[model samples]
Target: MRLYEFEGKQLLEKAGVPIPKGFYVTYSAMGAVGADPELERIFDELGGREVAVKAQVLAGKRGKAGGIHFADSPEALQQVVEAMVGSELLGETVTGVLIEEKASFEEEYYMSLTYDTVARQPVLAISREGGVDVETFAREHPDKLVLRRFGPIVGLMPWVARDAAAEAGFRGRELRQIAAIAVKLWRVLVDNDARLVEINPLVRTADGLLLALDAAILLDGDARVRHPETNFPPRQATGRPLTERELIAQAIDEGDYRGVAGKYVELDGDIGMLTSGGGGSITLMDAVAAFGGRPANYTEYGGNPPAEKVYRLTKVVATKPGLHGLLIAGGIANNTRVDVTFEGIARALEEIRPEYPIVIRRAGPGEEEGLRLMRELAQRLGLDMEVYGADLPMTESARIIVEKAAAYRQKVEGK
Candidate 1:
């Protein structure tokens, strides 16, 4: 779960991180004109400081993409606020703008705590070069990068925090100040069960005060059960709304067995795919696309998904009207019998009996039994089926599906 910028800022503020002063404005209560009075009042309360108008979007690179702007004057600020509110960023609409006082920067730094995939643990990263993409900074200037591993049992200690800042080129007093804040940030990361806590432009003032210019935080949904106070607002997709199936899949992550298993995502293509195994699916998708077939979906039928479950999911995929083909390709897992998956496939073929071209590539445990069942079913129903053996690699299977789909498309277009 990802918290909106405002929510994340609230948490940061509570953790003693100095953030720019800002307030959120909603669309319904006030048109930009109606909100003028309140805005003026806040501006007056702030004693005349330059402000920033930023669109609250989920994705990053907002600044480069014109999602952020500066307004030195009240009129300029109002114009920016008016332009941003109700606008869309990427594919997500902005409900409001974060009106914040601009900070005077003497120096900028980057800091973040994120789960490290390779180590399978949380890692803290810091850099003296700030306000830019952290990944880009890490890649371009490896020497400026400072990384520290955090253990699950002890979490991030004061000594580790000080060392991280020192490694980022901070000296003496500055290192001490930054290190204290880093310790606090670690506490926030752990106590809140956050997946990420990033301050990309942590700034220092001429007077030696440090503050966060921007913040982005991602909550660990798996740990949300423990934190009742955490909240996320409704995220409207910027372009078209998410499909019903996508929303259903998104909602399915509330309990045990909740993670979205299999590689499944919606795409703007003509073939619905249900391939299994990680490497096999990747190989097959690339092959399918390379061979001129546009996949309508990406799915994986994992080792022995319950027959009924697979049948139900297949029925869902079959409902896509634009679907030109279905590809069921994957290397059979050594441990799971192919017959289990075949049972589901057979049931789905009977249940949907979709008119679109269907392609199958099967191999693995119970390969003979699975093929026999598919062949028997095809014969009994008088349905034309294409089932291939696992002797062919995933790429070949994908190419066959793509070629078949292209032929189908040509035939339909000709008709």
Candidate 2:
């Protein structure tokens, strides 16, 4: 789960990290004319000072996309805020704006505390170069990036923070302040079960006070039960807001923990994909695209999900519009029963009877029975379906589906 900038800043403030004074103004609050008296009062409360109007969307690169605007006066701020409230930023609708006091910073630094999956440990990365393109800078000047890895047991020690800050070119009092912020940030990560806590442009003002100019926090979705107090809305993997179907899929998964049947992401394509296994799903998606197949959605169901769960998931996938074909392929499963998965898919097929060509390549436990069930159902319903097993490569199955979908399209187009 990714928290919005304002939410992340609130967490930072609570963790004792200094952030600029800001308040969020929703689109509804801005009114249609953006002439709400409350907005004017908010500007006045900030002493009519120079402020920044930042669009509060989930995606990044907002600055490059004109989502971040600077205002020297209340009128300019209101204009900027109003302009952003209704616009779209990075494919997400701008529903709110974070109006924050603009600060004069003498220097900007980069800092992030995140879990390094490869190392399986908490890592603190700091760099003197900070801004919107910190990533590009890091890639170009790897030496400037200071990294410190902390053990799971010891966590991020104060000494480690000091060492990282020193390496990032901090000195004396400023180094101590940076180290303190690092500790607080580590605490934020641990206390919130966060996967990443990043503060770009940890700026130092002319007065020598360090403050976070921008914040981003991503919590571990699986660990949500650990932090029952945090109420964040569901979001897609791309960080865009979830679609209605995606939300429904989430609810379906949450309702039953019997099997891992909840990995569904809607994409802009014509082929509906039902794949399994993490690596397998990725490979299939790439293969489908490589073969000129535009996948409508990505779905994974394994661990032998029940018939009802599979039925619901298949129903969701089969009903997606613009679907020219359906590809059901997966890696050879260890425990997931093929028959059970097919039963659910067959049930959904019996109901929806999608005209698109369907391809299946499932080979695992109860493989014969599963393939038989799918074959019988397709024959009984007079559906255009092709079944495969481990004998044929998954990528080959993807190619067949692409060809079949193309043939169907040509036939439909009457060309």
Candidate 3:
């Protein structure tokens, strides 16, 4: 969940890090174009004509992608905003443009804080090399990079930060300033559930001030429930926005941690898929596609979650519009109880009462009871459905559902 630049800057400011005076603007790309009157007021508020215009998107290398530009006057600002807002940068749609007072810097530096796998804790990386790629700087000039890993309890003490700055060859004033920033950034990372908080080109202004010239922050997705103020919409793998159903599905597992029922990716097709296990979900998706069935989503539930979690997951997936059929299939489960999981699906079906066809093939502990429960539920609901067990291979069941869904879709469409 990589945040936009303006959002990151907000986090930085709240954590007591110095940043350039700025505000951000967002508008719809498809809407009619015009110079916003608010832009003029913001220009006056900045008390200067010299401003840096930056695109707000998840993509990186924004400068190289022409997402960064300078505007010296009202006319220039309008042109830059029009060119930037409602545009594309680095293949990402630009919905917002940040307008800030440009800085006159004497020197540039880099700073970052993130979880370190090897250290098994949060680590801070700082370097005198600022405007360049930090990874390349660390690799090429390891001597210039200073690394500090912090423990969970007594995290990132001030004196330790100052020592690290001294080790990086900074003298008194610079050492104190950079070390202060280090402490504030640690606060930001911990408080905001930020997986990565970075400042590239952390600058020393002409007035001898340390400031964050750029903010690159990525938030932890699992902790999103704790920070609704961020107001981020769920996004798919390719950056498209998630559907309402997908967002609902994701919220199901929040704070539960018992099992996973939130790994849902909505798709274009119509078959509602309720696959289980780890690799089993993906493998079933391929099987369905291989058999000419179009799955409405890719989702899973495993680790023997309570019936409540599965009921929520089932409700979300089964309720998707244009669902021609529903497929509930998974591999042989070692511990996931079939009766408990199937009861959740049955409960959701009772609420939805869909006329669409359904097929089920799950095998695990209490398989017979689960199958019987599903069969009885379908009969009572008067739904057209079939229940299978371990005897029917998952792939074969996939083929059967594909054929049935196709026939059902054709029948509905009068094709």
TM-scores vs. true structure, each candidate: 0.81, 0.91, 0.72
Off by over 4 Å in 1: 26-49, 72-78, 115-122, 150-152, 233-241, 248-264, 277-280, 290-292, 301-309, 333-352, 363-377, 380-382, 388-396
Query: Which residue window of length 10 is worst by lDDT in model 2?
Result: 30-39
The local distance difference test score of model 2 is 0.87
* Off by more than 4 A, model 2: 32-34, 239-241
The parts of candidate 3 lying over 4 Å away from their true place are: 28-35, 90-92, 136-143, 220-238, 243-263, 267-273, 277-296, 302-327, 331-337, 343-361, 372-415
- Per-residue lDDT of candidate 3, residues 309-385 (tens digit): 99999999999999999999999999899999899989999999988999999999999999999999988989999
Q: Write the per-residue lDDT of candidate 2 for residues 29-124, one digit (tens) a residue.
A: 866464667767778777688888899887877788888888877677778887889787888888899988888898988999998889999999
Could you arrange the candidates by lDDT from highest to lowest? Answer: 3, 2, 1
Supply the TM-score for candidate 2.
0.91
Write the residue-wise lDDT of candidate 1 on 60-159 in tens digits.
Answer: 8889989988887666767777778778777777777788887778999988888898998779888889998777778888889888887868888889
Global fold similarity of model 3 (TM-score): 0.72
Return the top candidate by TM-score.
2
What residue pairs clash in candidate 1, if any at all? 91-238, 92-238, 271-296
Residue 16 lDDT in candidate 2: 98
Positional deviation of residue 220's Cα in model 2 after best superposition, in angstroms: 1.8
Error (Å) of candidate 2 at residue 61 is: 2.3
